[model samples]
Target chain A: MTEELLRLDGVSMQYGTGETRVTALSGIDLTVSRGELVAVMGASGSGKSTLLTVAGGLTTPTSGEVIVEGNWLSQLSPRQLATLRRRSLGFVFQDFNLIPSLTVLENVTLPLELDGFPGKRAKRPGLDALASVELLDKADRYPVDLSGGQQQRVAIARAVVGGRSLILADEPTGALDSTTGEVVLRMLRSRVDAGAGGILVTHDARHAAWADRIVFIRDGRLVDEAQTPPVTTLFEGADR
Target chain B: MSIRQSFLAILDQGACYGYQLRAEFDRRTGSTWPLNIGQIYSTLDRLERDGLVERTEADDSDHVYYAITPTGHDEVAQWLVSPVVRSTAAPRDELAMKLAIAITLPGVDITALIQAQRQATLRNLQELTRAKRAGGDGGAGDDLSWQLVIDSLIFQAEAEVRWLDHSETRLVRAKASGLAEPMPIDETRARRGRPARGGVPIDGKARA
Candidate 1:
């Protein structure tokens, strides 16, 4: 049986109070199992970013339970939550977010090192992640030396390092050209196929096509969801 | 692509009769655009008139083949090397025309029209995506051409979806900023019971 990597039950988030209250999410129930890639699509201010933040344990939902890797986020202590985030979850952002001072390898290994793993211990996993992105040869190169596409690959490597079970990417391809964006998305898809669960927040339908499923949000609510049929089905009735 | 140039290029390969040329064209293109025999014969007749192709000796079954002339070879080569020119005149786009007129006409629910069109475009996008995925594995020898054709269609459908989304956003912004508003119909004139022009009901029946 596949393992459930993340789950949100009756998730709702609101800011302020009374007339000033703004509900960012309302009754959002979602799940991401191992080897699954879910795409969250919506217009700006539709709570896609908030959903990712809540799912990654960076923000606590007002009155709901967020379970990641079998642990309830609300139940974990602040330190425990931080450790969980450092060890179990990985994030990819639109800006590529690599530390300018660090080399590719160092950027990928930073999370492991912050979780108390020694540099020597983190080296293997860091190298493995870089290799997964086909960038092992660029391990020693700093972010400035690489192209935009290569830098995004490095960011992907950092997100998947240390065998993290969940990957949350917010407009991860927003910075790259269409061709480069596809390459980054392909890498993310392969990583998810290798058993990590992922949620991709994007506005592009073409980008969302890479996901196994697409969830559409509107006005802080789940408006629609679609399961992309396998490519085999897509080819049916096509002249051979 | 010009059918005339395509036929010349194909004839450059070898001499072929009209039916054979049509079949070969269909085979090469994966039948994306099937050609009619009459169209093929007419094009061949025109090519012959232009001194680009000549009737070859008849075969055993009396099949008269057409072979590309030296001039035709040059034309084919030139066509292959030349970039297609895009006309500056507006293309006949039904959706664009509809929306263009709809926005100016009173009592037209522009937002609803945009939403409806968006949904239809999205549906087309989904179908095209499925076809693209099915044709993605261009493993077979003949599959590559078909895959490329499907990819082109997929790209076009995706662009349409993007355009629809952009139009919706622009319309919303325009409405929010009061840059676009439904022109108030002359209700007094309508109440006088005069028939509306161009099907726009000036009668209170028309939506605001």
Candidate 2:
């Protein structure tokens, strides 16, 4: 079986119409394996956001294919893609997209509720995911009552509550201070440690430091990948 | 390995302080490597905290003497044979990261990275050389210690520039060879070598 859980084959994404149109992604390809933490880094307008959108099935590519969890994204219907996203993918946005009226617990449980889970049972998973982020105690507080970092943690808890096999965080720590950012990063890293694959998007070198692999992107192209292997004697010699 | 192990490895051979370790590192690497004294002291403190080294009130007044623990001996021996874990922070290693990403990146202009590094290294080399020449031509009494340091920095900077030049040439050749094809994801995989598993290389042979 292919070890890759997500892949893009000759993918291209374009913006605008005809004469003035810009090619956001051109002839791009990428693969992310299970249990790996991959970072997507690029400068502004580099199609990094577009690639993340396509990889998460939030948008479609103009050409080529996106395969997630061994199933071709093109093969799935709109409803199927939506379902796949809910069950298999966890998404963290740059802004903490929690509902203002909802308490932290309610916001996290919303995904499970949308999937037809009963409110009472959904609460259990919501709190569990929150505990993973060390925010379970803040479950009853409204978004307005929480700080920006806390809200992001709530968003993270919501993303992971449904047992997603792949977690997609797009600049998850972009809104927090460095110390808080490190905390958020460690929380994201814990997912991979617990056996889930993750794709982290960040332009900050410091922020991307925790990834097992970092894939650099620019002008819609796959530039390079850095892998972190377990320390061994061979690694020391090779590094030297 | 623990901080104690590192401290013991450095001190077990002889009594030395943080500054001495920095000098020793430069000497062993043929003065082709330099370490910041602050980093050395910080590591030393951690080692001391871990009880790997005992501090002695030395006469130098400028530095403390450190003696290694027995635990340090066993640890260093094991560490020498153990495989080093490649750090994820490699991307932060200014030169290594630049080279690793030089080929695949678009819009980065590898020539620019190389040129910038070359210019900076050359500037430092020239500055140090001038300083050393002035020091040796002596309007003041000779201080061999400071002269040795300036000499070390000059050589190290020269070595760094040469290494960067070699890397640039390799990159240019790789691109000319058409091996720099628009980086396909699969091509990146090929360059990444065999997977972490004990797999053979793409050519059905074991990688040396």
Q: Score the docking of each candidate (DockQ).
A: 0.17, 0.03
In model 1, the runs with Cα more than 4 Å from the true position are A230-240, B1-3, B13-51, B54-66, B77-151, B170-208
Which structure among the candidates has the greatest lDDT?
1
Best model per DockQ: 1
Error of 2 at B195 (Å): 54
Name the candidate that leads on TM-score.
Answer: 1
- Expressed as tens digits, the lDDT of each residue in A96-176 for candidate 1 is 999999998999999999989999999999999999999999999999999888998998888889899799999999999
Two-chain complex of model 1, DockQ on C-alpha atoms against the true structure: 0.17
How good is the docking of model 1, by CAPRI class? incorrect
Local error of candidate 1 at B160, Å?
2.0
What's the TM for model 1?
A: 0.76
| Candidate 1, B1-208: lDDT as tens digits | 5889989999999999988999888777767776678889999999999999999888999999999999999999999999988664556789888887788787888767766665555555556555654444556878777867766776776787688778878998998899877665656634445544545433436534
Which portions of model 2 miss their true places by more than 4 Å?
A1-3, A229-240, B1-109, B112-208
- lDDT per residue for candidate 2 within B1-208, as digits (tens), equals 2434555666878879778876766454334334567767787787778777778886757778877777667677888898877553323567776667666766677867776665555545545543444444222434555556555565677677667757866877988888765454554534455466644443555445
Docking class of 2: incorrect
